[model samples]
Target: GPDLLTFGEALVSLRSAGPLTAGGALTPHLAGAEANVAIGLARLGHRAAFAGRVSDDELGTFLLRQLRAEGVDVTHVVRDPGRPAGLMFLERRTADLTRVLYQRAGSAGSALGVDDLRPALAAGARVLHLTGITPALSAGAREAAGWAAETAARAGTLVCLDVNHRSKLWSRDAARAVLTPLAGHASVVVASDDELDLVGAPGADEETLVTGLLARGVSTVLVKRGGEGARAYTADGRRDAAALPVTAVDTVGAGDAFTAGYLSGHLDGLDLAGRLRRAVTLGAFAVAGHGDWETLPRRDELSLLDSRQPGDTL
Candidate 1:
């Protein structure tokens, strides 16, 4: 049985290989918010599992292979023979800004159904990680994400929600309609400062947003502020973690990395402050490297960050 289970869409990201243009060199990389978390957890010495749908195409096969290579169990993943896998294009103009274009309509991932969920597998996990991106895919995908969360909750598994709201996926209103109710089922809620609108608290300050989510049955809320740092609020009180200093290469998957680090620390019996520290540390690592899951640090690799010398040893 896996320690952590996550359900969502995994897509192939085609990024600009050379120059920025209409028809520039493109490079393919596997990416998905939830999948990235699963990979990160696995890298951090946790047993993680992924549940989602992908087509029986080359891209789909490649994604599955990558997940297994990262030690993420893919037994719950469905390979739909009819629909193709989802795909997205990422344009990296700079280290801080990235524009993503999605071509995932009617894709296998968007067709995820409740029947695709293996509740038996989820029941063995300690936490079920979810993201707002899957629900924004389609109605079926929305239902599937909700079902997985509810199922895990019923089995006494903690539900962790990441409101990774994407403007390209859906409007703020549409996102709120689905994400708010879904968040009520989660034990923990994670959202970026700009994405607090998903919980129907648009433009509200960090304190207000945290209070709102707590009142909505969420026991804990994490507000992620890029570069500035992150804050966590619980019934007991609140804690903060400063962002680790690093020269950022790409910031696209930093949140997922943070979530993975947080979950890994939680499962390892770390205190709230320790979990938050691990989260910020991994978030910094994500930005310092290129690619999504590829940049995540393993448990042993974390000490390398403590090195101040140029030529450091393990």
Candidate 2:
């Protein structure tokens, strides 16, 4: 019922029974940062679409199937028969920990351009969710991410920007230059403490950093601090709450889950504190599952967390 479209990479993931995916991992659920958020939103009963580049090869098709299975609109997902879908290796370090290694080179996700931006932000879509990783993929992909922000603004969709800074992909200066401007156009933003540091506020306190974002035009900022809980600042107010306790599991997709929760609350018109709690619970659930996209809880399950024991209701 909402106008939400999230754009980013979707790669086929392999879970190796052995140490790694140097041809030893078992095939598991396929997912990525962008895919996880899109699926999460769809599962929350919102009509979501993913707009990004994917290879036309088998892996690309597999990615599409997963999206469709999760009820995500795949029309905006373009296939590049000339390229191949990227692949990733996720290794379980322990029952509660995992290590990931990337092998995404020459993947079709790098072929994005400005044209893909407008179509995905088509009429009826109210938000365009983006991450910092897409811009790090390639020049064209970066342009596409920028275009998505600009196009979404032109279309009147709120921009939801997540500062997922992967230092392995780009330098701090490069990240600040690209992400800060894109963030300037967003009304809502999510970032971890470390990411905000890379965005040129390497030593600013949480309060000042988030306030800086509002000064730059963003109305809402959610700073996610693992274990310590998360804090949200809005034009109306700010709130700090504890993260839900759970047996810690894989940490790969926790941030994405937090994002999904906040966006769901945003769509539902929940207040600041209500949104923070939902975000925390979903993050706890993400690490509990083995695979990234596999562990994502649907709206029903998330609703259950809001029980009668003096809990916040959606």
Candidate 3:
């Protein structure tokens, strides 16, 4: 049994060097919010497992092999012959911006359901990490996300929910309806500053939203502020950490990296300040390179960001 478990739609990403209209070359990479977190934790030396569905095609095989090579357990992943795997194209339109186009409707990953979650698997892990993107995949996937969280909570496994809302998948209203209740089962909730309301009151202020979640039994609430850094609120107190000053080449997976770092810190029994520091450190690594999990730091490489000079080499 792994220490941390996560499940969602795994994707084959095609990254374009320029606009799609100026098609030259497409670089392939494995991607998924939950899978990215699993890889991040694995890179940091944690036992992480990922459960989901993928097509029985070569792309699916590639995804599985990539995850296995990263030390993430893929025993629960199903290879469906009837459906194709999901795909997303990352168009690097400019130096500071990247546009994503999705073509994942009716994909195999979105076919995830309650039956895919094994009770014993959920019970065995110390933490079950979920994200808002899973529930947005389909009705069956949504039900599976809720069931996994509830089952994990009942088994005394900590449930960590990352409200990684995607406007491209579902509307805000629809997302709130599903994610709010799902959050109830979570011991820890991670969301961006704008996404806080999805798991909280729609129009509530920041403090009010955080307080409301805490009052409703959520043990820890983490709000990610992108370039502004992040904040963690708990019964003990609130802690804030500034984002590392790094030139971001791609900001796609920074949040998942942060979540992985925070969860890793918690598993290591680190204090709140220590957790926030590690979270931001991992986030900096993610944005400092291309692809989703490609630039994630290993456990030993965590302090390199703090000590490296502009031209310093190890």
Each candidate structure's count of clashing pairs:
0, 6, 0
Summing lDDT over every window of 10 consecutive residues in candidate 2, give the lowest-scoring window.
305-314
- TM-score-wise, the better of 2 and 3 is 3
Q: 95-141 in candidate 1: lDDT tens per residue?
A: 45777788999998999888888653444789999999999998888
lDDT of 3 by residue, 63-140 (tens): 999999999999889889999989999998986778999989999999999988874354489899999999999999
Give the range where candidate 3 is weakest over 10 consecutive residues by summed lDDT. 115-124
| Number of the top TM-score candidate | 3
For model 1, the local distance difference test gives: 0.87
Pairs with backbone N, CA or C atoms under 3 Å apart (clashes), candidate 3: none
Better of 1 and 2 by TM-score: 1
Where model 2 places Cα greater than 4 Å from the true spot, the runs are 21-23, 93-97, 303-314
How many Å off is the CA of 264 in candidate 1? 0.4
Q: For model 2, name the residue pairs that clash.
A: 3-125, 3-126, 15-26, 16-25, 16-26, 56-80
Clash count, candidate 1: 0
